[model samples]
Target: MRLTPDNDLTARAFARLDARLTRETERPVALALSGGGDSIALLRLATDWARARGRRVLALTIDHRLNVESGGWTAFAGEAARAAGANWRGLIWDGDKPQTGLTAAARAARHELIADAAREAGARVVLFAHTADDIAEADLMRAQGSTLGRVREWSPSPAWPQGRGLMLLRPLLGERRGVLRNWLAGQGADWIEDPANADPRFGRSRARQALAGAAPQAMDDARAQVGGRPTMDGEAMARVARDIGARTLAAALVCVGGGVTPPRGARLQGLTARLKAGEDFAATLCGARVEAASDGVRIMREAGELGRSGVVPLVLAPGVEAVWDGRFAFRAEQAGWSVVAARGRLASLSDADRAWINRLPAATRGAWPVLVRDAGLAPVLASEGIERRALVVERLRLALDETTHEDDLISATR
Candidate 1:
């Protein structure tokens, strides 16, 4: 907690991130600047690193607008970014705030906004300032019965199609909050402290207070091997049936289902057991339809379940891009375009296209997403000035491979 700028600290931070940055092309590096001590330190370090390499830096701040001070924070972030000789953008989470689960909702909004902004800015990697203290706090929360997941030093962006091709880098994961704040203080830098960090109603804040007087436990490096192809045919399913676990199956369901959350643990376990038994069966979980037939086990987004799950067609303006059903990323080149499930519209496709669509599993064809024009035009099939990619399936396939790093997954998608 010494108030002295440690050159070793800067060197260490740069060392941790240099290799990762070097692997990217000449595109600008993006950072999520929250105006907090951790993110401010990241901005400073990343700016220095980028400047030395003659690269540009883009700092993005999300104005959740939940607090009266949010606007000021975004302004502060802009000023800070400019002072650091970096470009700045302010994104707003402008919508109705939920009455409950506000923290989770805010986090989701933050990720989506940041991912969209970073991708739009031509950045393939976004930097975050998660420190060792945050990891300890998460561990404590999990110990207290919270189902928090582990945070890695590098990972793909959590937001779906918006974060499709973006990788998240956490260079400060080995650093501590106090050390970062001390370094910022020594540099004569100031930052805004969000009151929410200390709000006791939040689990993170409570965990922080509880750990104030305790030492953090050493975290384990063990990881569950939950890898599989995006879609497994009957032969492939049988090949991995003996090795497939509930965690792996659940991930497939979530990925193919185009849903964010995974299925309940107990139900997932039951389904895993049934699938392992190697019997022909059909089941739906978390908005995904999983069927095991003579053809194989095909898991796909349940188009009929979308309305019940509150997923609506995505409306896109000209020159705009969006992800529909969290499965496909679509870019609209013409005006008045939208994306919807292709259930009843299969007949509108050309004969050749219909033949190709018919070859796919019968249950999956209906749930396939297709682009449409407002003028009662022919069904678009990733051609004719429209671009569509199944990025979710690609990510799932990469994620299921145990050897694939999150960084490699992003690069592969790009």
Candidate 2:
């Protein structure tokens, strides 16, 4: 079946995108446009949706600086967004580029840049143009021994600080790549195919090559789950008989774990099985410790991991906010302050500061970020803001419900 813009398929895609928007948000919505078929199609559809609702859309294109052609590609993306009647800007990932883990670093940088731009533009929600093909590729990667799990339709910004108070929406997961391209074709629009997509060096390209002839299916479990805290009820989880429910629980553990990535599927499965067995025990997986609480399983960041791992300290400018250790994002009142994880430095806590730090979960207390200036501890930041706050506290506050663990799973997976 051939798909075209204004056809039934496109209409359905538009409906799916519109349904996810609910009401106009308090702030503007932003779209990450890559000048690719999927994102350009999204730009066209989103601009119309925004226009009908009288809401503004900010189209942000990130130039990763990974390639010489990246600049030209971003300029094309900007033009596409403007043609679709949306405000557009290009963000460049400047500064040190790592030699190893370039792909992983670039992906993180892309999310960070887009999310930061969205925040700066006063947009609380940012939409991505990941299609069903992308989801299928993620599934393929998982099947090929990749540690990554299924990509959810809606999720929080995977990057900190920029991710704070921001929601990432993927509305095109229901649409196939061919269908989206068909829409762009009908509109006489074109897109650039990044060379990295076909390069054998990337796992994603290999996955795409493996599935070159396979048909990507529509995701059935596309319903949005309300965000909740990271904790889950042992009794409640024991009642979960469905495989999807268990996977959802696993995703929650990974989210709250504060790991750079979610744990492997087998590990998640084992954890789920242990939870369903109803045994009270404590275990660590993916940077989070899961222990049986009076009510259920309380999973929080593994404080021990913070001490072993060397985290990159962030330079905080005056009035600039950033996230540290996936737990907390804070702003400095003055410049020349550096935010670092407390870790072994907890011994430096004063009497007043220790009082507040004592209130946090023991396993995750050491993961908090503290400000330092001129080799002296910044006591005001530690006692007043940093100590009283948990890493996921801002995320929890932004969630639809402040209470409930299972209901607050941070994933947007169907």
Candidate 3:
């Protein structure tokens, strides 16, 4: 491909993407195309790269259905993806929308929808078009007391089990928004400008306005020092240093608690302090129970929170897959399958299964999902035609592992 000044952006971005696709190069790559300048530019670049490599590109657009024009935007995204020679999938955020915290909720919904769509399409890496301008805006928001964390060049998808094995790549994070828009214009392409981006009511809009006419600042490459094991055993984390322990505990709580957001600020510090001081106590944070005992600290999902959160038994049909309670990814290969908590049914379990369940912490055993066929219960670990996989534990480990760098391939936790 010829590299004009405008087209050079595509070359550079493609190189970044190429570096990240060291593994899974044969798999179809997916991108989140929002009909915006950056994403449209990404679509073209990704399609070109995929085409040259004889790989396929899956472009996913999420319709949050928040604005009247969202349907039009999704259509635009689909058309853009098809024009770029990529397969397009439109996902809808159906049902009732939250009255408050709409932005956060919409973002969460977008991630979940995109992750599900990408996974369903057999793609493990999802490309995002976040640029330097986004990092600057995020920094401005954080300076103005927003709790947004720093955006990295590569990171795990934020959505739980649905995003279990997925990695998000921001190949254009080093590029500027204006440069990408110029490149798109050079190609005679157009994109939708969401009115919400300029609405002052949103923090991002206010930040964008505040940074108007200013050059985008370069972002630092600092990684979180958080570290943790892939299991729920508390003893493994007992002797960790204070600051590291606090960070690890936060990640552990979020993972084991099955919550997307990690606990922060004073409460987390207090809990870390107590644990560091060797205090034996039990507490709950982010829907996960944390117990610091003489045996060590054990963290598990708080079963009551599951009920309060309205999580129920998951029913799966043959050849269907679903995530249960944000923890396990369950796939049914047989006709009859349902996953329910193992709490009251422990006595009915086979002696061998019961023994295995007994080995786990008492608090965790009740919340463990057990497979059911008709009226009889089957051991999740030993069941036939039912593929049960724990998602959060290994994912959390990868997210918190210091050895896992941005360049490392985030293989599927399953």
What is the C-alpha lDDT profile of model 2 across 247-315, one tens digit per residue?
A: 345545545655555555577778777776776778888777777644666766677876676677777
Please, what is the whole-model Cα lDDT of each candidate in the order they appear?
0.75, 0.68, 0.77
- TM per candidate comes to 0.85, 0.77, 0.86
What ranges in model 1 sit over 4 Å off? 1-7, 23-25, 219-224, 227-242, 277-280, 293-296, 310-316, 336-338, 347-351, 371-383, 397-414
Report per-prediction Cα RMSD to one decimal. 3.7, 5.8, 4.0
lDDT of 3: 0.77
Residue 229, candidate 3: alpha-carbon lDDT: 40
Provide the global lDDT of candidate 1 against the true structure.
0.75
lDDT of candidate 1 at residue 370, scale 0 to 100: 70
TM-score of 1: 0.85
Query: Which predicted model would earn the best TM-score?
Result: 3
RMSD of 2: 5.8
Question: What are the per-residue Cα lDDT tens digits for candidate 1 across 255-340?
Answer: 77777776755788888777777778878898888776665566766667875666677887777767778777777777788887
Best-to-worst order by TM-score is 3, 1, 2
